[model samples]
Target chain A: MRFLHTADWHLGRLFHARSLLEDQAHVLDQFVALVRDVRPDAVLIAGDVYDRAVPPPEAVALLDDVLARIVVDAGVPVVMIAGNHDSAHRLGFGARLMAAQGLHVAGRTGPQASCVTLHDAHGEVRIYALPYAEPAAVRDALGLDLPSHEAALQAQLAAIRATHPPGVRAVAVAHAFVVGGAVSESERPLSVGGSGAVAAEVFAGFDFVALGHLHRPQTIGERVHYSGSLLKYSLSEAEHMKSVSLVEIDGAGQVTIEPIALQPLRNLRVLQGELATLLAQGMDDARRDDYIYAVLSDTGALLDPMARLRQVYPNALAMERTVLARSGQASAAGRQLRELDTGTLFANFFREVADADLDGDQRRTLDDLLADMAAAERESA
Target chain B: MRFLHTADWHLGRLFHARSLLEDQAHVLDQFVALVRDVRPDAVLIAGDVYDRAVPPPEAVALLDDVLARIVVDAGVPVVMIAGNHDSAHRLGFGARLMAAQGLHVAGRTGPQASCVTLHDAHGEVRIYALPYAEPAAVRDALGLDLPSHEAALQAQLAAIRATHPPGVRAVAVAHAFVVGGAVSESERPLSVGGSGAVAAEVFAGFDFVALGHLHRPQTIGERVHYSGSLLKYSLSEAEHMKSVSLVEIDGAGQVTIEPIALQPLRNLRVLQGELATLLAQGMDDARRDDYIYAVLSDTGALLDPMARLRQVYPNALAMERTVLARSGQASAAGRQLRELDTGTLFANFFREVADADLDGDQRRTLDDLLADMAAAERESA
Candidate 1:
C-alpha cells in the first residue's frame, strides 16, 4: 500500500509578522496537483494542521477548501492528528462524519483500544494515530503522573503497543521532539527548561513512524522520519529545503520511503551585503522577488533602512544593521543596566533600537529626568 | 411541506457586555428538540447565524454541533442564508457538499442564479433563499448602480422573480427590513440615513416570505412573517415574545403559518429601584438569576452599585444612576462648556459620571487649572 506522509502545514503562520496565507495557498494548490498525479491510497498528515489553536476565519475556510479538494475531489483517504499548535476540540469536531468521507481526524483522543486497519495485497496494515498530548493529559488518560515529555510519549506509544497487532506492518503517526533530531529556532519548547525529547527507540516494533514538531526534515532511524513544515516559517529555516515523505509498503510488509521536494511560489532567501551594493548590482534579479531577510554591513550612517530596502525588495520582511548590533552587544558586555547612568543607558538604548543618537531636545529631557531622580533620592535618604 | 423558520440567532451575542453563549446554547438545544418532535420537512434559518462575521471557536463549534444534530442525526434538510452580520464567503465555504447532506447554506450567492428544491407530497416546493446583499453588491451583481436599500432589494427581488416557477408553492427567505415593521433600537441599521425598509409589495409574486433583521415578531401580510430572534438580543427587546415560525404549505397551493414560542433559559430583564433595596428584598429570588439591567433610583451616592447588585443578581450587567442622570441632563440643557469656569465644569462632569461632586483636593486642582488657563490666555494676548 502506498501512502504520502506530511506534517506541520502551519496553514495560518505569520512569517515575520506578515500573513503567509497566500504563499501557503499557492503551495497547497501544487500539493493538490501532485496528489492527483501520485494517486496515493491515503495521505497521513501527522499534525499541526493549523498554526494556532484558534485560527482566523480565512484559515478555516482555506483548510475546508483544501480538505474538500483532497478527500472529495481527489478521492483519497486522509488521516490527520492534532499538533501542539492546534485546538484538538476544534480539529476533532467533525471526525466521525469526515471518516465516512475518507478523512479521519484524530485529536484530543486517548490510546485507541484498536488501531485503524487499511488493506492492500499485503492483507492489512494497522495504523496508530496519536495526537500531541500534554504530559498532564497523558497522565490523566493513563492514571500515571509522568514527569517529562519523553515519559508521556513513551507511555502513549506503550499503550498503543500493548494493542499492537502481531505479524503485520504497523505505522505510528506522532508529533514530538525526539532525541538526536535537528532543531529549529521557531519550535516552541514543549517543556520548560528541560529537554522535551523522547528517545528514537520508543517505536521499536513499528515498521514506520511519521513525525512532526520539528520544521527540519530528517531521519533518526531507517523507519522514523520528520516530514517538516510546508514553507519557511522562520528565517532560521531560510537555507533548509522542505519536502513530503512517501511510504510504500510491500505485500511482505517491507517499507521504502522517499522525500519529494515541493516547488514553493517564492523561496525564502537571506541576503547579506552593504545596503547599496545589495540593492544595486550585487543581488540577482531572479532572487529579488524572494522573501528577503537582509543584513547590512555598513558601519556609518544610513537613513530609513527598512523603507529604503522596501523600495527595491518589496518582500524584504526583516532587516538587521550588523555593525550597530555588534557594537550594541559589545557595549553591554561589561555592566549591569541599573549600575549605568540613566543618560548613557538611554543613549545606548536609543542607538541600539533606532540606530541613531538622541537630538539636543531629547537629551535635555533625559537630563531633566536624571536631575529629578537625584533630587528625589536625596530627599528620601 | 412543513418547516421551522427562525432567524437572527446571533449565537455569540453579548447582552449588556456579557457573553450569552450558555443562554443561546440552552435555547438552541430546546430548538433541536422541537425540530425532532415537529418532524418538519425542513428547517429554514433566514440569516444571522453568528453574532459576528468571525465568531469565536466555541461559537463555531456550537453551530457545528447543532447543525450535525439537526441534519445528520435528525435527518432534516436545512436552508439558511447570510445576514448583514456574517461574512458570506466564510459561511458559504463547503456549502455545495453540505447540501448533499441535507444542509443548504446560501451566501456570497449571485442574485437569483438558482433555487433549492425540497420534496413533499406535492411535486416540489421551490425555496428561493436570498442572502442579505449590500447596495454595492447588488449594483455589481445586477449590473446597475442602485440608489438605495429599497432599490437593491427591489433589484434582487426582480432577479428572483425573473426565475419564479409557476404552479408550485414558492417561499422566499430574506434578511431585510420591510416598510412599517416595528423598529427596535438594537437592530443594526442596514444603511445610513432614512430607513433601509423595502416595501412589503416586493414579495407580491412569492407565496410566502420568511424575513429576518427585525427583532420583533410581526406580520406585514397574510403569507409574510418575521420569526424574530430566538432570544431577546437587546434591552429594547425586553418585552418581545420570541418564537420560531412554523410554515405548513399544502399540496393544493394553500399555506398555514404558526408562530411557536421558544422558552429562553434565562430571560433578559430590566429592574428599577434604590441600590440597597435591590440588594435586600426589592427583587424576587426567582427573578434574580435573569440577566438584569439595573436602574438605580437613589439620589444619594452609592458605592459599586454593579458589584452590590451582582451579589443578588449574579448576572447584573449594567447600571444607571437615574437621579444623577436626569439632573445632569437638566443642568447641561442651556449651558455652554466655554461659558463655565473650569471648577464648575469639572464639578458638573464629575457629578454626571460618579454621582458626586469633587472633594477639596480635586476642587483645588480644578481652581489651579483655571488660574493657569487665565495666565496663558493673557500671555498669548
Candidate 2:
C-alpha cells in the first residue's frame, strides 16, 4: 500500500499580521503537481487542514480547488482528520456525502464510524482516523476518569485496539503532541492549563502512524512520524524544514517512510548585519525576496531602519537592535509614564463603557462634567 | 412542475453586533422542514447565500449540512447563484463536482455555464441562473457600453432571450435591486457610488423570475417576484413579512405562485414606550423573548438604560432616547475639541512615521525632545 502522508497545511495563515493567502495558494499549486506525479493510491492528511476554525474565504476556495485536483484528477482517496486548531463541527460538515467520492473526512475518534478500509494490491488496509479529543469531553463520553490528555488518547486507542482484527494491517492517522517531538510557538496547546503530551508507546501496534500538530518533521518511534506543518508559521520556525512523508507498506505489514521537502514560495529567514552594508550588496536575489527578520548589529539605532531595509527586502516583517538584546537588561525603566487629559481620558472612558467610539452627545456631556467638577472644587476650596 | 424558490439567507449575519448564527440556524431548520413537507421537484435559491464575501466557520458548516439534507436526503435538486455580497470564487468552489450530486452552485452570468436543466414528470425545464454582475465586468466581457446596472442586466437578458427555444417554459433566477421594490438598510449596494437598481422590464421574457437582494416579499411585474430575506435583518425590516416563494409551472407554459411564511425562533420587533411601563407587565411573554429595538419615550436621559433594559429583555439590542430623535437638529456642533499632550502627540506622530509602536529608546528620546520643545516655546513667548 502506497500513500502520501501530509498534515498541517494551515491554509489562510497570516504571518506577522500579513496575509499569506497568495503564498499559500502558490505552495498548494505545487503540492497538487507533486500529488499528480506520485499518483499514490491514497493520501493521508493527519490534521490541521485549516489555519483556524474560521479560515478566510480565499483559503476555503484554495482548499476546495486543491481537493478536487487531488481526488478528481489524481484519483487518490484523501483520508483526513480534524486537528486541535480545527473545529470538528465545521470540518466534518459533509463527511458522509463526501466519502462516496473517496474524500474521507473524519472529525471524531471512535472504533466504529472513524475507521475506513482501502485496498491497494494487498488485501484491505484499515485506516483509523483520530481527531483531537478534549479531555473533559472524552471523560464524560466514556464515563472514565481521564483527567489528562494522554489518558483520553490512551482510552481511544485501547477501544480501537480491542476492535482490531488479527493479521490485518492498519494505518493510524492522529494529531497530538507526542513525546520527544520539538514544539514551536505556533502550535496551540492541546489541553488548557495542563500537561498535554502523550507517550509514543501507545502507537506501537499500528503498522504506520501518520502524525500532525508539530511543525518540525521528525520520527517519534519506529513506523511513527510527524509530517509537520506544510509551511513555517512562526519566526522561531525559520530554521524548521517543512516536509511531507510518503509511506509504502508491503503485504506482510512492513513499512518504509520517505520525507519529501516542499520548496516555499517565500523562505523565512533571520538576517543580522549593519544596515548600510546589508543594503549595499550583502544578500542574494532569493534572499531579497524572502520574508526577513532583521537584527541590526549597529551600536546606535538608525532612523527608520525598517523603511530603509524594505528597500533591500520588500518582505521585511520585523526588525530589532542586537545591541539592545546583548545589554541583558530589561528596558521597561526607560518607558514614559502615561498622563491623562479630561477630553481624551473621557473619550477613552466612554469607549470602555459603551464598547464603541464616543458620539457627539457623550463627548459634550463629558466636557461639561469635567468643567463643572473643576468649578465645584474651586467653590469648595 | 413544482419548485421551492428562496433567497437572501444572509447566513452568519451580525445584527447590532450580535452573531445571528443561532437565529439563522433555527430559521433554516424550519426551512428544511418546509422543503421536506412540500417535497418539491427542485429548489431554486436565487442569491445572497452568505452574509459576507467570506462567512464565519459556523455559517459554512450550517450551509453545508442544510444543502446536503435538501439534496441528498430530501432527494431534490438545488440550483443557486452568487449575489453581490458573496465572493464568486468562494461560493462556487466545487460547482462541477457538487453539480454531479444534484447541487448546482453557479457564480457567473455567462450564456454557456449558468443554465441548469432539471427533469420532472411533465418534461425538461430550463432554469437559468444570473448572478450579480459588475458593470465593468459585463462591459468588458460582452464588449458593450454597459454604463449602468439596468443596462448590464438588459444585455444579459437579451443574450438569454436570443438563445431561448420555442414552446418551453423557462425560469430566470436573479439577484438585483429591481425598480419599485422596497429597499432596506441591510442589503449592500451592488454598484460603487451610484444607483444599482435595474428596471423590471429586463426580466420580461421568463415565465418566472425568482429574485433576491430586497428584503421585502413583493412582485415587480407579472412574472418577477422577490422572496425577500429569511429573517428580519434591520430595524426598518422589522415590519416586513419574510417568506419563501413556491412556484408551480405546467407543460403549457402557465405559472402560479404562492408565498409561505417562515416561523422564526426569535422575532425582531420595535417597541416605543416609557421604559418603566414597558418593563412592568405591559409586554407579553413572547415579546419579552424577542430581539427588541427599544425607543425609549422617556423625556429624561436615564443612566445605563441599556443595561437595565437587558434585565427584563435578554435580547434587547438597541436603545435610544426619544428626546434625541425629537430635537429636530444635528448635534455635531456640541462636541469637545481634542487637546493633545506632548507624549501622546509625539507617540502618534512617531507611529505614523515608523508604521509601528515605539520601543524604550524611542520613547525616552521623544520625551526629551518634547521637553526641549516646550522649554523653547516658553522661552520664545
Candidate 3:
C-alpha cells in the first residue's frame, strides 16, 4: 500500500516572535498537491502537528483549511498524533468523533497499547500511534518502571506485538530524541542528563518507524525515518532541506521511502561579507523574495548592520558583525588565561565582567580546573 | 443562500494557563453537526479565528479537522477574514491557493478591495470581505488623510455599491467593534479613546453584515449581527450562550438570521457563597461537566479558596472573594478616603503602601479633595 509518512508539521508556531504561518502554508500546499498527484492511499502525519499546546486562531484556521482540502476534497485519509509540542488532552478532544469521519487522531499514550489497523487489498497494516511519552507516563501506562524512553517504548511495542496477528505488517509513529541521530540546533532539548537519549534499536521488529520532534529528515537505520518539519522554523535549520516522506509497504512487509519536495515560502540565506562590500553590492535580488540573516565582518569598530540591511532586506530577522582576529600573538597574561583550566577561565571571566566576589571554595575549585581540562583534552585527542 | 455565520474562534488560545481547545472543539463539533443537519450553502467565519497571531499546533489540527468535515466533506464553501487579534499578513498566507478549493480568506484591506460573487440557485450574491480595517490602513488604502473607521468603511461600501451590478444581493463581513453593541469583557479593548466605537450605520447598504471581534451573539441593527465566540474565553463571559448565526438571504435582498445552538464542552458557572457553603454543597455534579469560577463571600477569612475549589472543581479558572458589597456603600473613613482627589489619593496611598515621603504640595492636594467631592455631590443630587 502506498502512503505518505510525514511528521513534525508544528503548525501555528513561530520562530521566536516572527510568524512562520506563510512558510508553513506554502509547504502544506505542496503536501496537499503531493497527495493529489501521488495519490497515496493514506497520509500519516506522525506527530507534532502544532508548536504549542495552545495555538492561535489563525493557526487553527490555516490548518483547518489545509487539512479539509487534503482529506475531504482530495480524498485521502489522515492519521495524526500529538507530539511533545502538543497538549495531548487538547489534541485528543474529539478523537472518537473525528475517527468516524476517517481522520484518525491519536493524542494519548494508551494504558495497554494503542494501534490503528488499516486493511487494504495487500494485507493488514497495523500503525502504532505512539505520541511523545515521558518516562513516568510510560511507566504508569505500562504498569512497570521502564527506566528509559527506549525501554518504555519497547514495552509498549511488546504489548502491540502480543495483540497483533502473526505476519501482519506493522509501522510505529513516534516523537523522541533518539541516540546516534543527528540533532539540529533548532530542535528543542528534550530532557536533561542521560535520560534524554532513546536507543534507536527500540523499533527493531517494526517494518518502519516514522519519527517526529527532530526537524531534519534523516534515517537512523534501514527502517526508521524522520520526515522533518514542513518548513525551516529557525535560522539554525536554514541549511536543512525540509520535506515529507512517502513510504510504500508491500505484502511482504518490506518498505521503500521516497522524499517529496516542499516549496519554501522564503529562502533563508545567510550572507557573510564585510559591511562595505555588502552595502556596495546591495541586496536587490535578496530583497525581492526571501528572509535574510546578514553577518557583517567589520574588524575595527561596530556598525549599524540592521540600519544598512533594512534598505535591502526589509524583513531581515537578525544581523551580527564578525569580530576580526588580533594581528599579533596574545600577551603572556592572555595566554596564561587561555591555558588555565575551564573552571578558572570561567571564574576569571565572570569576575572581570561582573566584578563579583568569589568564595574560598570556589577559588579552590578554579585552581583544580587545569587538571580537568588536561584530562578532557587527553580523552578527546 | 443559507450560511452559518460565526466569528472569534480564538483557536489554540488559553484562559490564563487553561487550554480552551476542548471547549472550542466541542462548539465546532456542534457547528459541523449543524451544517450536516441543516445543510447550509456556505459557512461564514467572520474573523478572529485565533486568539493570537501565533497559535500552538494542536489548535491548528483541531480547526483543520472541523473545517475538513464541514466544508470539504459536506461540500460547503467557507468565507473567512482576519480580526484585530490576528496578524493579517500571516492569515493571508495561502489565501490565494485556498480560494481554488472554495475557501475565501481576506486578511488585509487592499486598494482593489475584496468582493467574491458566489453563484447560487437564487442568483449571484456579492460577498464583500472587509477584514478588520484599522483607521490608518483604511485611510491609506482609500488615499484619504483624515479618515475614521466609520468614514473609511462607508467609502468602501460606497465603492462596492458603485462597482457591483445593481439589484444583486450583497452581504458584507467585517471584524470591528461597533457602537451600541454589547462588548464582552473577554474582548481586548480595540482602540484607545473614542476610536473603537464605529457607528453601526457604516454597514447601512448591505443586506446583512456578519460581524466579529465581540464574543457575544447580538445585533447592532436589524441586518447587522455578531455570531460571537465558540466558547467562553474568560470568566466574565460565563453567562453568554455561545452560538453561530445562520443567515438566509433571498434575491429581493430580504435577510433572515437564525441562531444555531453550540454545545460547550464544559459550562462556565460562577458561584457566589462562603467557602464552607460552597464546599458543603458538594459541587460534584457541576464539577463533572463545568469550568467554574467561585466567588467566596466569607465574613471571616479562610485559607486559600482556590485550593479548596480545586479539591472539587479542579478546572476552576478563577476564584475571588466578595469582601466588598455590590452597592457603592462604605464606612465614614472609607467615604472620606473615596472623596479624595485621584492625585492626592494616589500620593497618600503610595505613601502608606510604599512608605515614601510626600511634599507639602501633595498634602495641599489632599485638602482640595473634600471641596471637589462636595461640589460634585451637589451638582449630581
Candidate 4:
C-alpha cells in the first residue's frame, strides 16, 4: 500500500508578523499537482492542519480548495487529524458526514472512531489517527491516570493494539513531541508548563508511524518519521529541507519511505555580512525576493539600514547588529563611546528603546532640543 | 414536493455587544428537531447561514453540527446559499465536493452551477440559488449590463429560465432585498453605495420565491416569502416574530406555505416605564431573563439605573432616559434646568459625552473639585 504521508501544513501562519497565506497557497498548488501526478492510494496528513484553532477565512478557503482539488477532482482519499494548534471540536465538524466523500478528518481522538481502514492490492491497511490531546483529555477519554504525554501515548497505543486484528498491517498517525526529536522555535509547547515528549519506543508496534508537531523532517525510530511543516515557519528552521514523506508498505507489512521535497514560492533565508556588501549583493541577488533575516557586521553606527536594505530586498523581515553583540566588552564600548557623536549615541539609544530609527522630523526635533539645552547651559554659565 | 424553507439565520450574531452563540445554538437545536419531525424532502436555507463571512470557530462548529444533524443524522438534504453578510469565496469552499454529501451550498451565483435539481413525488424541482451578489457580479456572471438589483435579478432569472426545462416547477432561492418588503435595522444593505432593492416582480415565473435579507418574516408577493432571521439581532427587531417557512408544492405547481414559529431561548423586548416601577415589575416578571431595552420615564435624577435594574432583570442590555427626550421641549427643559442640581447636570453631561455614568470614585473626585473651586472663590472674595 502506497500513500503520501504529510503533516504540519500550518496554513495561515505568519512569519515575523508577515502573512504567509499567499506563500502557503503557492506550495499547496504544487502539492496538488504532485498528488495528481503521483496518484497514491491515499494522502495521510498527520496533524496541525492549521496554524491556529480559528484560522483566517483565506486559510479556510485554501484548505477547502486544496482538499476539493485532491479528494474531489483527483479522487484521492485523504486522512487528516487535528494538532495541538487546532480546535478539535471546530475541525471535527463534518468528519462523520465528509467521511463518505473520502475525506477523513479526526479532530478528536477516540479508540474506535480514530481507525480508518483502506484497501490496496495488498489488502486492508488500518490507519489509526491519534489527534493531539492534552493529558487531561486523554485521561478522561481513556479513563486512565496518564499524567504525561508518554503515558497518554502508551495508553492510546494500547487501545489501538487491543482493537487490531492479528496479522493486519496498520499505520499510526500522531501529532506529539517524540523523544530525541529536534525542536523548532515556531512550534507551540504541547503542555502548558510540563514535559510533553513521548518516547519513540511507545510507537514501536505500528508498521509505520507518521508524525507531526516538529518543523524539521526526521526519523525518531526505525519506522517512525515526522514529515514536518510544509514551509519553514521560523528563522531557526532556515536550514530545514522541508518535505513530505511518500510511504509504501508491502503485502508482508514491510515499509519503505521516501522524502519528496516541495519548492516554496519564497525561501526563508538568513544572510550575514557587512551592510554595504549585503546591500550591493542584494541588488543583483537572484534570491532577493526570499524572506530574509539580515545580520550586519558593520561596527559604525548606521541610519535606517532596514529602510535602505528594503530597497533591494523588499522581503527582508528582520535584522540584527552582530557588531553590537561583539562590542559588549568594555574595551569595544569605550572605543565606540570615544568614536561616536552625541546624535549617533542618541539615535542608537532611541533605536534600542523604540525598535525604530528616528525619522527626518524626529531627528530635527532632537537637534532643536539639544541646541536649546546647550544654549540654556551657556546662559546659566 | 414538501420542503422546509428558512433564511437569514445570522448565526454568531452579537446583540448589544453580547454574544448570541448560545442563544443561536438553542434555536438551531429546535430547528434540527423540527427538521427531524417534519421529514421534508429537503431543508432549504435560502441565505445568510452565518452572520459574517469569517465566522468564529464556534460558529463554524455550530453550522457543522446543525448540517450534520439535519443531513447526516436525520437523512435529509439541505440547500443553503450565501447572503450579503457572507464571504462568498470562503463559504463556497468545498461546495462541489460537499454536494455529493447532500449539503448543497451555492455561495457564488453562476448560470448553470447555481441550479440544483431534487426529485419528489410531484416531479423535479429545480432550485436556482441566486446567492447575494452586487450588480457588478451579476453583470459579470451573465455578461449583461445590469446596473441595479432589479436589473440584476431579471438578468439572473433570464439565464436560469433559458436553461431550465419547461413544464418543471422551479424555486428561486435568493438573498436580495425585495421592494415592498419591510426593512429592519439588523439587515445589512446589499450594496455599499447604491439602491440595493429589487422589485418582487423580478422573481416572476418561479413557483415559489424563498427570500432573505430582511429580519421581518413577511410575504412580499403572492408566492414570494421571507422566513426572517433566526433571532432578533437588533433592538429595532424586538417586535419581529421570527419563523421558518414550510413549503409544499403539488403536482400542478400550486404552493402552500406555513410559517413555523421558532421559540428563542430568550425573547428580545423593549420596556418603558418609570425606573422604580420597571424594576419593581421585573422582580415579579416570569420573563425577566428576556433581553430588555429599558426606556426610563422617571423625571427625577437617578444614579446608575441600569445597574440597579439588572438586580431584577439580569438580561437588561440598554437604557434610555425618555425624560431627557421629553425635556428637550422648551417648557420641560426650563423646568428641568430649574429643578436639577449641579451634580445632576454634570452627571447628565458626562453620560451624554462618555456613554457611561460616573462611578462612585469619579463622582467623589468631581465633588472634591467642586469643593476646591468653592474654596478658591472664597479666598478670592
Candidate 5:
C-alpha cells in the first residue's frame, strides 16, 4: 500500500504578524501537482491542518481548493485527523457526508476512533485516524482513569487493537509528541510542564505510525514517523528541510519511506551582520523576497534599522540589536547584585548618591548598626 | 415532486447583544422533526445559512448537527446556496466532494448557475441554484453590462435557460429582494437606493421560484414564494409567522404549497406600559423566559428599569422610555424654528441668553442687518 503522509499544514498561520496564506497556497499548488504525478492510493494528513481554532476565511478557501484538487480532481482518498490547534467540531463539519466522497476527516475522538480501510493487491490495510484528545476527554469517552497522555494514547491504541482482525495489517495516524521526536518553536505545546509526551512503544503493533504536533520531521521507533510541517513557520525553524513523506508498505508490513522536498514561495532565512553590510548584500540577493529575520551586530544605537533593511529586503519580518542584548554585562550586574554584602552595598549606593565617601566615624556607626541588626535577626530566628 | 424549502437561518446571530444560538437550536430541532415527519424528496435552503461572513464555532456545530440528521439520518438530499451574508468561499468548501453524498451547495457564481437534478415518480425536476452575486461579479462572469439586480438576474436567467432542456420542469432558487416584497429592519438592504430589487417577471419562465433575502413568508406571483426565516431575528419581526414551505409539484407542473410552522423555544415578545406594571405581570407570566423588549411609558425617570425587570423577566433584552422620546415636542420645536422669522427668533434667543429683552433700538438695528442678509442671499441665488 502506497500513500503520501503530511502533517502540520498550519494554514492561516502568521509569522511576525504577517499572513502566510500566499506562501501556503504556492507550496500547496506543488503538492497538488505531486499528487497528480505520483497518484498515491491515499493521502494521510496526520493533524494540525489549521494554525488556529478559528482560522481566517482565506485559509478555509485554500484548504477547500487543495482538498478538492486532491480528492475530486486527482481521485485519491484522504484520511485526516484534528490536531490540538484545530477546533475539532468546526473542522469535522460534514465529516460523515464527506466520507462518501472518499474524504475521511476525523475531527473528534471517540471510544472507537474513525477507521478507514483501503485495499491493495496484497490485502486490506486498516488505517486508524485518531484525533488529538486531552486526557480528560479520553477518560470521559472511554470510561477510563487515564491521567496522562501516555495512558490516554495507550487506551486508544488498545481499543483499536481489540477491534482488529487477527492477521490484518494496521496503520495508526495520530497527533502527539513522541518522547524522542524533534520539536520546533512553532509547534504549540500540548500541555504545560511537558506532560503531553507519549511513548512510541504504545504504537508497537502498527505497521507504520504517522505522527504530527511536532514541526520537525524525524523517526522515533523504526516504524514511527513525523512528516513535519509544510513550510518553515518560525525563524527558529530556519534550518529545517520541510517535506512530506511518501511511504510504501509491503505485504509483509515492511515500510520504505521517501521524503519529498517542498519548495516554499518564500524561504525563511535568518541573516546576521551590520545593517550596512546586510543592506549591501541585499542589493544583489536573488532571494531578497524571502522572509528575513535580521540580527544587527553594530554597537550603540541605530536609526530605524528595520525600516532601512525593509527598503532593500522587502520581506524582512523582524530585527534585533545585538548591542542591546548584552548578555555578559547583564549577567555581571546580576552577580554583583547577588554577591555584595548589605552594609557595603548601602555604603557604595550612599557614596554614589551624595557624591562623597563615607567618613570613618560614619563607617563605624554603620558597622555598629549592622552588628545590632544581625543580633536582632538571630533573636527572631 | 415534493420538497421542503427554507432560508435565512442567520445562525450565530445576536439579538439585542444576546446570543441566539439556543433559540436557533430550539427551532431547528423542530425543523428536523418536521423533515422526519414530512419525508420530502429533497430539502432546499435558498441562502444566508449564517448571520455573518464568519459564524461562531457553535453555529458551525449546530449546522453540522442539523445537516447530519437531515441528510444522514433522515436520508434526504439537500440543495443550498450562498446568501449575501455568507462568505461564499468558506461556505462552499468541499462542495464538490459533498455533492456525491446528496448535499449540493452552490457558493460561487460562474458562467452558469449550478444545476442539481432530482427524479420523482413523474420524471426529472431540474433545480437551478444560483448563489448571491453582486452586479460586478455578474458582469465579469457573463461579460454583460449588468448595472443592477434586475439586469443581473435577467442575465443569469438567460444563461440558465440556454442550457436547460426544452420539456423538463425547472425550479429556480435565488437570494434576492423581489419587487414589492415586504422587508423588516433585520433584513439587510442588498444595495443602496434599493437597487437590489429585481422584478418578479425575471423568474416568470420557471415552474417555481424559491426566494430568500426577505424574511417575510409570502407569495408574489403564481409560482414565486418565500418561506421566510426560521425565527424572528429582530423586534420589528415580532408579529411574523415564521415557517418553512413544503411544495409538491404534479406531473403537469401544477404546484401545491404548504407552510409548515416552526415553534421557537423562547418567543420574542414586546411589552408595553410602565416598568412596574410589566414587572407585576411577570409574576403571573408562565413564559417569563421569552425574550422581552420593554417600552416603559412612565412620565418620570426610572432607576435601573432593565435591571429591575430582569429580576422577574430574566430575558429582558432592551428597554426604552417613551416619555423621554417626546416626538411631539421635538417636532413642535422643529416647526417653531423653521417657521419663525429670523428677527423674532434672534430676539427670543437674546432674551434667553442675556436674561433681558432686546431694546427698541437694538431690534431696529437687528432688523436692518436681517434685511441686508436677505438681500445678500437673493444676490447669491
Candidate 6:
C-alpha cells in the first residue's frame, strides 16, 4: 500500500521571535500539491502538529484549513497524533467527531495503545498511535514504575505489541528524543540532562516507525525516520533540507522510504561580516518576498544596524550586532557559567547594578525578573 | 416557520477571569435540545459568534462541534454574521466554502444587504444579510462621505431594495446597538455614549429587523427586536431572562414576532446579605448549580470575603464587600473625580504611597508606570 509518512509540522512556530506562519503555509502548500500529484492511499502525520501546547488562533485556523484541504476535499484519510509540544487533552478534544470524517487523531495516552486499522485491496494494516508519553503518566497509565524516558517508552511499546492481533502488517508512530539519532541544533532541549533520549529498540516489533520532536529529516536505522518540520523554525536549522517521507509497504510488510523535496518560502541565510562589507556585497540571492535575518560582525559601532541591513535586505526579520573572534581572557568557570543557569548570571548582574545585598525579597524579585527575561529571550531567539 | 433568532454568542467568553468554555458548551447543548424539539425552519444568529477576534483552540473546537451538530447533522440552515467584536477578515476566511453546506456566514459590510433566498413549499423568502458596519467603513464601502451609522445602514437597505427584484417576502438581519432598546448591562459597552446607537428608521423598509449586540431580548417597536445573548457574560445581567426571538414572515411580507423560551443552563443569581447570615442560611437550590455573584454587607471587616462566600455559594463568580451607603456628598466634584483619568488616579495613589513630591522626572516615571499598568489591566480584563 502506498502511503505518505510526514510529521512535526509545528504549525505556529516562531523563529527568532518572528512568526513562521507564512513560511509554514508556503511549505504546506507544497505538501498539498504533492498530495494532488502523488495520490497516496493514506497520509500519516506522526506528531507535533503544533509548535506550542497553546497555539494562537491564527495557527489553529491555518491547521484547520490544511486538514480540510487534505482529508475533506482531497478524499484522503489522515492519521495524526499529539506530540510533546501538544496538550494531549486539547488535541484529543474532538477526535471522535473527526474520526467520522476519516481523519484519525489520537492524542490520549491511555493504558491500552490506540490503533487505527485500515484495509485496502492489498491487505489490512494496523497503525499503532503512541503519542508522546511522560514518564509519570506512563507509570500511572500502564501500572508500571517507569522511572526513565527510555523505560517508559519501552513499556508503552511493549503493551502495544502484546495487544496486537496476529498476521497484521503493523506500523507505529511516536514523538521522542531518541538516543543515537541526529539531533538538530534548532530542536529545543526536550528534557534536562539528556533524559529525553529514548532508545530505538523500544519499537522493535513495528515494521516501520515514524517519529517526530527532532526537526531534522533523517533515518535512525532502516525502519525509523524523522520527517522534519515543514519550514526552518530557527537559524540553527538553516542548513537542513526540510522534506517529507513517502513510505510504501507491501502486503508482506516490506517497506520502502522515498524522500520528497519541500519548497521553502525563502532560503534562510545567516551572513556574518563587517557591516560595510556585507552591504557592499549585497544580497543578490535573497528572495524579495521572503523573510530574512541578518547578523553584522562590526567591532566598531554602527549608527543604525537595522536601517543599514534594510537597505540591502528590506524584508529582514531581525538584525544583531556581534563581534566575531574578539580577544577574550576567560577562565573555565566563566566558560561554564555561559552553559549554566542564565538566571544566576542575571541575578549577579542585577546585584551589581543595585549594589544591594541579596535579601530574601530582593532575591525572589531578581529570580522572577531573570526567569521572565530568559523566557522572553527563548521566545525571541 | 418556528425558528429561533439568537445572536452575540461570544462562545469563548471569559467571565470574572475564568474561561466559560464549559459553561458555553452546556448552554449550547441546551440550545441544541431546543432545536431538536422545536425543529425550526432555520437558525438565525445575528453576529458576534466569538467573544474575541481571535478565539482559543478549545473555543474553536467547541464552536466547530456545535456548528456541525446544528447545520450538518441536524439538517438545519444557519444564517450568521460578523459583529463588531469579530475580525471580519478572519471570520470570513472559509465563509464561501461553508456556504455550500448551508452555513451562511456574512462577515463583510460591503456588498451591502445581500440576501440568501430560501425556498420552501409555501413560497420563496429573501433573508437579507447586513453584517455590522462601522460608520467610516460603511461610508467608504458604499461611496458616501461621513455618513452616520443610521444613514450608512439605510444606504445598505436602500441598495437591497433597489436590486432585490421584488415578489419575494424579505427579512433583514443586522448587528448593532439600536437606540431606545433595553440593553442588558452584561453587554460590553460597544461604544462610549452615542457612537454605537443606530436610529430605528434604518430598518423602515424591511418586514423584520433581527438585531444583535444588546444582550437583552426586547422589541424596539412592532418589527424590530434584539434576540440577546445566549448566556450572561457579566453579573450586571443577573436578572436578564435570555431567550431567542421567532419571527414569521408571510407571503405579503407581514411579520409576526414570537418569543421562544430558552432553557438556561443555570439561573444567574446575585445575593445580598451579611457573610454570617448567608453562611447560616445554606440555601440549597438547584440554581446553586448556576453562577452566583454575592455582595456581603460585612461592615465589621470580616477577613477574606471571597473565602467566606465560597462556603455558602461555592460557584460564586465574584464577591464585593459593601460598606454602609454613605449620604450624598460632593455631588459634582466627586462624580468628576470618579471619572478622573485612570493615569492621574494611579499617579496620585503612587505619590501618596511613596510619600514623595512629584518632580518632573518622578512624574515621567509615574506616567510610564501608569501606562504600563493600564495596558496590562486592559489585556487581563
Best by lDDT: 5
State which docking tier applies to candidate 1.
incorrect
Better of 1 and 3 by DockQ: 1
Second chain only: TM-score per model?
0.83, 0.83, 0.83, 0.84, 0.85, 0.82
lDDT tens readout by residue for model 4, A264-376: 99998989999899999998899889999888889888999999888989999988887776766553465346545466779999999999999999987886676556334
In order of appearance, the predictions have TM-scores of 0.78, 0.74, 0.56, 0.79, 0.80, 0.74
Task: Give the clashing residue pairs of candidate 2, or none.
Answer: none
| Tens digits of lDDT, candidate 5, B25-109 | 9989999999999999899999999998767878888998899899889999999998888877778878888888888998878
Model 4 spans with C-alpha error above 4 angstroms = A16-18, A109-113, A139-146, A271-289, A292-321, A328-381, B109-113, B136-148, B271-289, B292-325, B328-381
lDDT (tens digit, per residue) of candidate 6 on A138-159? 7988899986788888988888
Highest-scoring model, TM-score:
5
**Residue-level lDDT tens digits of model 2 in A302-346:** 899899899889999988776886685332212111223446655
Give DockQ for candidates 1 onward, in order: 0.15, 0.17, 0.05, 0.27, 0.32, 0.13
Model 3, residue B103: distance off in Å is 7.2
Candidates 1 and 2 compared by TM-score, better number: 1
